[model samples]
Target: MASTVIAVLEVTLSWLFANAKGRDAKSFFTRPALANFPEQSITVTSPDCGASGSKLQVDYTQDGTGRFPALQWSAPIEVAAQVKEWLLVSEDPDAPLPTPIIHGIYTAIPASKTSVNTDDFTVVDQAKALMRGGFHYGRSRNGLPYIPPRPLMNHGPHRYFFIVVAINEELDSELLKAETTREQVAEAIEGKVLGWGMWVGVAERKWE
Candidate 1:
């Protein structure tokens, strides 16, 4: 009886807290690590997403219900050549847990003779598109997209980083034509990096 009463009290307290804040009590309890993020020299922006911008949406899960925002960046002139086989990597350094989360990885942007203006998400031409098979970007388990059964909550707000790397040589057009992993793309660009840039955004969904 005593334990039952304690449980009831706990539930009531949680309920009150949830109502007081406009979020779930559990969400309120979680500590989002927005402060301890790594410093980056480059600046990133998304013309199609963010509260102040165009606000394009990104679905976080396979159910396609919850969505995050789509992001883009402005490429500087020095990094333009490397953009041809560019690799965009997003990572959270300060996960509440040990291992950092890799939120997104996109590759194979067109090499820009000039700087890429903001709002350029897709490759400019058919030839520059990441080959259909291996180049598509998303969360994949063993190279296949599999949505998790249970959501990983309480992880705090994850920092989504987008990095652009310039490659030295033209990748194997035949291998790229067949589709390749971002790792392979990185391998192709290993020696010839000209310049790189990165930007970050924060996101998290906690249960109340």
Candidate 2:
């Protein structure tokens, strides 16, 4: 009977300890930078080669789903600096808006990983759901998932920048409320913007 009680206490203690660390890991987005954080390199990739600044068709489809373009990046991105979290941001600079239109805001990408595989919506969605406790996907302007660009008639080709940045600290869910903008995410990771990699993809709409 005494051994049983001890076993229960041990398990309870271990669970408590893990939750405490989890809290710290999830607190990065809310913590302010006390000093400048060092920079570390991270590579962002996509199966869709936009290196020529090519245009991404809005009606594009992949695996029976809206083509969200697969994005891959370097993994275990430890410059051995103060870093843990990563943020995936996609925005269009020329969307006829006051500021660039934000398309996606995904945070808490594990540092011990690589390749987001956005091409597989199921994969990304599963990750988003599992990470609900610590990570979040900020909604776009239209309150949708990572969105592809759709320019108006003759709006010309729009430059969409897909940026992958590493953060020195873990982010908190509270810091990333629904419909959070990239600017806001930037602000949160500003001082601690350890490193980043970006790929620019172009999209245009032609009106006859």
* Global Cα RMSD, each model: 10.8, 19.1
lDDT per residue, candidate 1, 115-155, as tens digits?
A: 23322333334454433223434332233322211123434
lDDT of 2: 0.57
User: Which runs of model 1 end up more than 4 angstroms from their true locations?
Assistant: 1-42, 51-68, 81-83, 94-99, 113-151, 174-182
Candidate 2 structure quality by residue, lDDT tens digits, 1-208: 9956655664554444432221212122222431243332555666665452555655442213456666777634245255587677777666554466667677776765555664333333443433322356776777665666654334455667676777778776765555566556666776666666666677654433
TM-score of each model, in listed order: 0.51, 0.66
Q: In candidate 1, where is summed lDDT lowest over 10 consecutive residues?
A: 26-35
In Å, residue 44's CA in model 2 sits off its true spot by: 2.2
* Runs with alpha carbons beyond 4 Å of true place in candidate 2: 1-41, 50-52, 57-65, 75-82, 119-135
